[model samples]
Target: MGQYPDAYVQYLVHFHGDRDYFECHEVMEEFWKAHPEDPRSATYVGLIQIAVGLYHSRRGNRAGAVKMLVSALAKLQPMDVRTLGLDAEELERRIRNRLADVQAENDGYTDINLPIMDPGLLHRCQTICRDKGLVWEAPSSLENDALIHKHTLRDRADVIEERARQSRLRKEQGEAR
Candidate 1:
């Protein structure tokens, strides 16, 4: 049970980040079945549903997307897992954003856009620069440079930690103002 949950969580992160929505659903289903009563289980399930909705949306299945996303939002709306392992607030924010996208599509809006970024590219750039002892002054400029090598797991973790620290500092400074 524990292994399945952990594996599911890993798969969730992997597939969600990679935009493999269907795989995300398949992975999370394993955990959802084992712990239907757990609040976190609902959170994972809701996320998978959201991903599936997104997949449907990309395929131009507007009705299917709306149905799936609405159900997913309903499932997520009652949960209070802000202090849990998952970022509940962010998940809700994403759901709301997706719902808006679906609404726009359904309403015949032609400019509907989704915010999707390539994590692998970002990681690769950061790792390559760090490995070469290159310092990046501007975060945005990192994308302009060519990636020379792939990032090791430890290097990737360090980059993530550094970015988190910088984000916290910015947040604290903003709060103090």
Candidate 2:
């Protein structure tokens, strides 16, 4: 019991890495039974569910794949994967791609093309645009001007004012009196 979490975690890594979905499910079940109240248990359970979904996906079980993957995604919603040794972005990409493939194979399912944009890139662009006093346009299909302004504009009115003041001072110092 003392080493259950660590041991189970190792097993999970091995099972998922090796694509042994059945063993992944069994190993995580052991951990879940022991650490039923553990806050981090959801992460492990979500991983196992994802592995099971991947296994079904690879074996051409579209219904099972969709069911398990959706469940896995829901289970993962409450936890940050960055602190759990899981690459959340990569997992999302994989899940989205897999779901798209499944949707393509099934009827009455809409294909979703999720944006792959990095949040960090968006933040950097916002900062640069704000500092430059340039208008920023967030990529959106709607043509509403106010919506565009609301989403893209950074609240940097104070910084812009300060920079203008500094520039005025520099200009005044350079002027001949």
- Number of backbone collisions per candidate, in order? 0, 0
Give candidate 1 regions above 4 Å deviation. 1-4, 37-39, 77-84, 106-177
lDDT of 1 by residue, 1-177 (tens): 012245444443443333445556667777678777875676666666776776566556788788888888777644333323334556666667767877786543221212223344334434544565544222212122121111111146766899999999999999999
lDDT, residue 37, model 1: 88
Query: Candidate 2 on 107-139: residue-level lDDT in tens?
Result: 432222222144543344445545655434422
Cα lDDT of candidate 1 equals 0.54
Steric clash pairs (candidate 1) = none
